[model samples]
Target: MSNTMRILGAPNLYLQGPGAIERIADIVANLGKCALLVADPTVERMLTPQLTKLLTSVGVAFASAPLVGEVTPANVARLAGDHRADVVIAAGGGKGIDAGKAVSRAMSARLVTLPTAASNDGPTSRIFIFYDDDHKLLSAERVPRNPDAVIVDTQILAGAPRHLLVSGIGDALVKRYEAAQCVGAGRPNMFGGRATLAAVSLANVCEQVLREHAVDALAVAGSGKPDESFEKVIEACILLAGLGFEGSGLSIAHAMTRGLSALPATAEALHGRQVAYALLVQFVLENRSAAFMADQFAFYAAVGLPTSLAELGLPKPSADDLRTISSLTHKAPHTRNFERPLSEDELTEAMLQLEQMRQHSAG
Candidate 1:
């Protein structure tokens, strides 16, 4: 038997429900004396007053920082700006939360993420992604540990745009397949340790939850109301998917993001939408059965996820374009987490096959 060590990375505390943001003061007080809250402009406008009142009630000294534009080292440093708080509260969408993670790392402060939208699973994981000004992915780095807490206020999430919720479902749906591939290949997780059973379980459950509740949740999303299905999908997107990917690692589905981001045609697409299309490429690479592919395509259609290259804004990519994407994808480390080594030629060929499959499905 192989004796590889297994590890699971997760936040210290996870709270999810309607109005969970109200408990932020008590949670912050438990973690540290003072707090630094980081938020994007929209969230700052909507929530700053409410959060300030809560923290003030508990006498938790706190300051606010605006998370603007992309997350870069310089931007994060500017936001941190000599503020020395013991705890950092990252509140808003994914970018806002990511800004908080960067600031917390810069200041060596504890982190508490209060995500307003379930756009992606960055909140509960230690990984913080950085991007260039053009919005291409620069790097993904981890803090010394995961956040002290991840607070998901479903009321806030439900009030977000329906498209954001759909993007999150698209992101969460791929975790099970990615985790299975990584574990089957005996790959080290993001923590550089073997995958634990808990990680695998969470990955499987994440996908199951998404498949079961995503459609129902989408119906209620953006209505400014929370329901059972919406709540479950939110947890799957923010918590289970976060732990699953960080603990079991990513594969071709995530690796392709590097290539997709490099192209202007797809560069500005939402991260989860990119992943959704890339997942179709992954299925082609894996040579999944036609029946399985058909079922997944049906699901994508129902959820309004992009199914064709044209839908992703690349209507007629040149051969050189395919080569550029394949070359960059081949260079990504996680691309090797598949069942076998993937050549650039194979990557390009898989994309072409995916296009053909899309045509056939449409026909």
Candidate 2:
């Protein structure tokens, strides 16, 4: 399979800080003349005037396509077909950015992503996830390349809901764990090549940033101020984690979370939140030491991540529920990415063990 090759992928340009959004007009102009902006309703309402002024000053004609619903293939297809523009800018939260990625791909337009919330790695990855009309995850579509640019205005991120940042930390926390597994096994990354030294290093850095700064960043993020810790955490969560996961690889942690979709009861849980708890299950599957598990458990609890299914709104998962989730994990393509075989029984046992630990930690 030519697994010896090394590969890395990333957005063309990444801009951050308080005034980054103000530069979007020039950035968009450099890429294309006329742009179509697909933004969440909230972004359209809150930032349109400033965005409009910037674009006008730069003489970049732009049109707005407000995102009215969840990111689904049908919705993205519709947007791509309906909007004829030189470039597509997905502005706002994860859904809007994902829609922008898909729509840009469908239309063959240059892509730009402006994320208002530091909630996940989707903002910069070459992958965009879509859900079915029923809100079930449909697929993770890989674009030909990453976004042309990813603009993260920490001013906006600072004002975002604190949970979003915490969830981002949850998502970023797994990068080193998963990447280390992939590297140790000589497994191929998302692009079907071995992880490069650079990719592995980025994953390690992402984990280090989260370990050191996430909690303090969460504290200042609530006040809506762009502090140093907030900037570092945002970079780790969005940029570094994006590069790390996509360029290194996803392992059991993500596979387990993806499996949670099989349960209708977990439909309301956030993606990052699900991954946070699933990491504990991975620890069990890997037979990590109790000291290591306890350290991770404490980190999750301090960051407000879901440490138990109860927090995920499924406090009492029946045996059937556990079996279903475990089976789903076994069926996931990512589960196979692990060096060792992953079984449904192991998943079930790990989940139960996670719950027991949660109880013990509580006591």
Quick one: best TM-score, which candidate? 1
Error of 2 at 14 (Å): 0.9
Q: Give the C-alpha miss distance for residue 108 in model 2, angstroms.
A: 0.3
Candidate 1, residues 134-198, lDDT tens digits: the string is 88889988788999999999988999999998888888888999999999998889988999999
**Runs of candidate 2 exceeding 4 Å displacement:** none
Residue-by-residue lDDT tens digits, candidate 2, 110-190: 999999888888888888888876567777787788899999989889998998888888888898988987777777899
Top candidate on lDDT is 1
